[model samples]
Target: MLSTSMTSAVIPIRTVYGEASTGTSSQPMNGTVVHEQQVRTARSYQAALSDWKRWAADHAYALHTIQPEAWSSNGGSIAHDKFSDLDMLIPLLADKRIVYLGENSHGVAEFNLVKTRLIQYMHQTLGFNIVAFESGLGDAALAQGQIKMTATQETMMRSIFGVWWTKETKPLFEYMKETHKSESPLRLTGFDIQVQSPLFQNANWIPSNGLKDRALQAEQEVHKWRMSKDLSGFRKAKRELIKVYEELLQVVTKNENALKMDYPDEPHIVKLMKRALEDRIRVIQEFNELCIQSNILTEQEDYSASQSMMEWRDRAMASNLAWLATEIYPEENIIVWGHNGHISKAQSLISTMPKSMGELMSKELQQESYVMGLFMGEGQAAENTREPVQLDPIIPGSMEDILSAAGQPYTFMDLRYRENERGNSWIFERMIASYQVMMPMSLELRRHFDGVLLIKQVKMPTYLPHKVTKQIG
Candidate 1:
């Protein structure tokens, strides 16, 4: 039975004629008129379950259950089986110019490991040369230099990403270092905004400890002047800070020709450095705008301004990705790593938000972009809480529930190819949240992602071996 709201909602209808008149009278022909409605009746819980079972049976080939051991075996270096579904999936993924892999949260260790291994496999077999991350551009550029120099995993991890500093990421950093030394070196880049304020404080920004200390001292002086309401002193400190960034940019740009001539073995690193310099300049400009807004905007307007800044940030990431695809690695395939929220191709439920980075990329790349979303059934993840919390059970009628009922420990469903009409309807009807509780108000799963990687359970990411301290620039 349909609820009042369901029945009252805009139901599509089709009209039909009961019979045709044999006598062709221009104005006085009488015939029976019938309204045949094409209504989509709401299904009961039992009905939906029955439908799901039928749909699952009809599309069995498209659903694959991945063995957990397959992923855990050999420390994520699973030996490829010619008949394996995963083996088949890789070739399909290789066809795309860009592939996006999304995680539910940054704190999922299991997911991260799987992603890292997948990246390695893709690079080894598919000729993907560049791996773009969600970290600040300046930070990634610094980490790239460290990796090239074969820096310790600890140093590389600490220097690269502000959010991804966990011990679980150690393997990935080590992989990058090893790959950087190879004849065909893989490139690492970042396509996010420079969120770190007083940018020099970011460990990834400056090369040497001396420059780091000098930048820190400059930051301190600027803060002190601001606290004292000393405009002249604050302006002087700000000028010094900007000058340092400008001088650094000049140094990097000036070495371009020399780097190309002397370091012809790895000329790509110089290109990355130039990109980082450009991003730093943009960060300074954004910081100045923030200061102006803080002084002039009202409380309500201030919130609006922040929202605008966030939208601008997403746009900036999209722009950076476009630049990378066209100018940097035009001939090579690229892989993008980011959270599901940033990479979903659908518009966010929030009315004020614009289309996400994924949506923009899909629009620009069209058939060339392949997006894969990762979801978990039940597990622990870090969210708004300080510690990791247990995930709620899959909600009935949700995408997770349907996928869970398929009885797969791990599964991959390709959204592009579906033969059963009912199965297509079931999969496309709703979008599933990575975490069960964070389901969106509305979503079209088929429109957002090309494939789904479902894991039965997950674990919280491990922190760095040493005492973990959160650093905010």
Candidate 2:
């Protein structure tokens, strides 16, 4: 990270289909020029895509050899050196403090493999040791606290969503185990506020139950609001929760040493105590946003996963990420794993929805953070344990089509730009970049992500077998 550039060990024999390394723009990409870019995106689409193949041939980073590792019999890596194709991105992302590696969904097989490779690169080369996942913050923290350094599969699965425990990601788990024995260690944590169970309310962590009693009553009130939207009751509960939380935070800040005596055997006792408190606060903050959402959508008969609900969740996530970056690991660099929708600076096509987490972080962290969105041309898509669906061919002029035309199985492009010069319309034009619903984000394509990594074709993730999951849990 100290330097922006690193030469790839194996460069392509010839630059085929935009396989050459090229910089798109010198000016920094930010919100200041979003309105201007949106106007530029209105340029003739046909003109932009006519030379798509030429642009792709000249700009795409062709990558077909970057595959997942092959494991040996004794938990050793039989896999060779890899991801040289990614060296081109070193300069674009090296200076970033927090890099969000995001997926269109939780289901792509190849996405996991490539992400693991990226994680390794970040850890070994860029000095990023912490990875904050979109999982339960308290659950992951408490699970990791029990381990000395390396974590077991079950412990990890228990903490995060099932999307991460796939066969493709098993190597990452093993890598964590291996690195723990060395001078460099890749530590895993979660930034999400939601937890499987209520945290820090038991007698083990808190000597007195005054805070716990107040928290339980607040929880009950929340449940009541869920069953029946009693806004007044919920308001009372939220106020009480905030009051009690402030008191607990004050005590922890004032007397962390005195509290540590209660957890004599715990290794990360201090972090555990503070993280548990943070978890509760996140839940409260989430509910606080939800209150706004409830005002908007609760009156409707069918309020199932409304856009407003998603907006509130994104707001909560942004808040948690800010806490993680500024408070939890101020000096250490971190990588974030989550969905493309959460990490993109692009606004939702529906103007009414709240701003996304990526947009918020873009404003908060500015150039210090980088977001890269993953997409594919043709592929099988699935959620965890669900049947895979064959993806329709790429839309004629979509970003995927242009990239796949590079004739390579994988390609990458940085969307940052100087000005909307002609022939690069595809980069600036209002086009769908993903295979899913292709909801228009109103902004120019370049604003959606700092850069994009393309997979020509992909298969659905190989979900971990039930027995494997059971054992891990």
Candidate 3:
């Protein structure tokens, strides 16, 4: 059962066939009818647990009861909540390079406990430093042989992102600040990579260590590609441009493999290798296109735009390498954080990270350095999702199939707050209204680092209301 604190007071209603439901009432409602229509828009959710159940059966996963960490007045510690996903994610977190916290998944209380406890385990039990996050000032502290993180600094970053910090995040941030204070904290540094490229700068875009710019680069690249006349020319120039990426992947893979051989039980080491390989391939592909489309790489004349792009890439890559190379402390443990797209997926700085910063450090960086990505809600929440898809824990099924199984009405009635659209519980109200109708599968992806947790959410629900009804004879 879903947590009650997460429940909404307003009941969302669906009009099955009544006059008021279908907008044929004697006195048509102002917007209640619209809300009702939204409530009846979809069906129910189920589980296709055959494969997962088999895996669970094969493994010796203790069914640890997961519940929200009910805090005591003293604030020292308390019992952990039993979560269905805990057993699934623990093995992955045993020994890994990166822990991905999928979008918004960790943001919630239940998921946050899984993530924070894993970090604690990594730091306290295993001798691992360098905790990373989806946000942060990267590599700057790495070069200084220290990570400087303060609770105040975190509050500032939270303000930047407009994310309201909860009691759950407090301990995690506190741990990070106290543990890595000597070392530079893995600040959530959201920089626009495209603007660092001269091309975007020339077009009036200034690069900032801001999420807005980092988020905007893909579209910018696409736009530049679309506007260019000879994309092939750019591709040709970029054919050899991804050499740095290939080298980074090769080195990380070899080093990670060596670490695995030394400690085969280190699951985090193995997982990092797999993630890095994927990231390397992606960067090479994207960079190749950028080089070819710009044609600036092979231009007979100096193309400032191409230079600017290259410079931007160089700077970002340099910063990442500098951190990875110089930041490791034999006496202290550190963890870094960055977005899933930057740390988990194939196109990030880790797999295809450049060597300049390593050179800057002079002492060759070891493969023992672990890198992981944290995910929030689902893996794809950061991606474009304009349409509805049944991609969650609930299995794919029709409306009647779900409602019949839940033994609940295929419809709900819209009641409280029908007059106010932007009520305090609007989003929740909307979700309740939407979920009652469109039961979706809750499929999620997760990766764990050496006792660190990372999860990605998929098939998330939004504001769009879906209506589902049984095609009864």
Candidate 4:
């Protein structure tokens, strides 16, 4: 049995979040933090459920719900055939160049299984040909570069974070490996600029020993920044890494043709590499600033800085994702996988947060993209992969409560309906800040997601024994 002594979500008195926090706490694992006044703790849950049922039934969409059993993975089989219910998603999403699949938390078994199903569905049915993870841009790129001839499950597994290397996620890797030989096979890419995978030796963007050495140094320094209790050597590390990245930036600009020559078969390789380098520099700067103010600033000020630091990451991710969609895979539709906070659009207008990747792409792509957010009503989230724990019950009258009241174990709804429509239309206008099943925050649901997928009860993932080098949420 899971421990009841722990919480599904961690609600601190007032804590700031950094990427390394790797938790749904210190703010939240996925989206913006929720303050007491920002959340409406009283709502008519039964009425909302009845109204939602009425809306879904009027539309004749399978109760607009798919039972969890229908979405299950094949037991130890490479073929994940639980796709009969996934066709329901086709019409709900926009026919766009990119569709972002955002998860509330990464470590849930159901979230990974369901999302893997969606990725496969979108790839085969909707022609979203690339699956870009929220991992190292270069690492995933190099990993993909090896996919056709020299790759294994381990190659793809190494490309992503440790949280995803699970039994639930194995089929996706198997599918990727199996399909690489087929015509127009699905491919992989990534948008994050951070270096997580230790594949720096394979970098071919530049032949500079200095650049390669600097990236390794930066990776080590970043490790120190995350692991060091005293945050020792940060200032000096920041200065050296920034100097190296800046100097390398000048070289990359000067030798753009060399990079193009290095990847003559790929489109926009030079620019993508440049953006990867640029974001690395900026992210370091942002992280450095956030860390400095973290200890010295007042509670609110620290929160603001921490949020901005995250936003900077969102901006960087947006830039790289745009390049992936428009330049790298110009002829192919793409699917992006990331955290809901990074994918949420509501941050654009919120004074408390900066523009998120969702907002950035919404502005850039106009009607050419769809961003979806995932949530869970109850049960265990493996955000802490080592020891699975239950998420706290959602606040009684919060929006999650209202959404959870739908008469199904799993439910999906498109957020395209006009807010002015009567009966359950309050959903569009309703502000719901979700850390999946954590403390509720405030944001108009319609503004944050084009659609939502809710699994009423979720189970934590079974972690891989040897693959996980360290713990992550």
- In terms of TM-score, the best-performing candidate is 4
Residue-wise lDDT of candidate 2 within 1-473, one digit each (tens)? Answer: 10112112111121113223444454545744322221122323344465765777677786656455444434323333454666776888788898988887677888888888778767766788888888767656655554343356765665577766788877776776556556656667776654443445343455457776765565444434444455556565676676776677776767666655543323445765576676566656565446444655656745543566666667767877787678777888989888887787865643455567788764658578888888876768675544686776665656776787777887877777335544455676555455232332333567778778888788888787543221000
Candidate 2: Cα lDDT at 382? 76
Q: How close is candidate 1 to the true structure, as a TM-score?
A: 0.73
- CA lDDT of each prediction against the hidden true structure: 0.59, 0.63, 0.32, 0.64
Per-residue lDDT tens digits for candidate 1, residues 1-473, read: 22224421322222222223344334432664444434444544456555665565444333243212233222233355522545656656867888888876766666677677667767666777778887766556555655545455644453445446565666666666566556555667778765333435444434567766765665444334323423344445566666765666665565566444433334466776667656655644454354334334533465565455555567678888888898878888998988776677765543555567777663657578888888776788764222686776655555666666666666566776554454346555543344223443335677777777777777777765443323211
Residue-by-residue lDDT tens digits, candidate 4, 153-209: 566576787777777776676667565655556677788766575445655756787
lDDT of 1 at 401: 61
Q: Looking at model 4, which ten-residue stretch has the lowest summed lDDT? A: 10-19
Model 3: per-residue Cα lDDT over 262-337, one tens digit each: 3332234433333333333344456435544446444656454454344344445445434432433333444443
List TM-score per model, in order: 0.73, 0.73, 0.35, 0.74
User: With candidate 2 superimposed using the best TM-score fit, by how many Å does residue 397's alpha carbon deviate from the native?
Assistant: 0.5
Clash list (residue pairs), candidate 4? 8-390, 8-391, 8-392, 24-29
Candidate 2 minimal-lDDT segment of 10 residues = 1-10
Sort the predicted structures by lDDT, highest score first.
4, 2, 1, 3
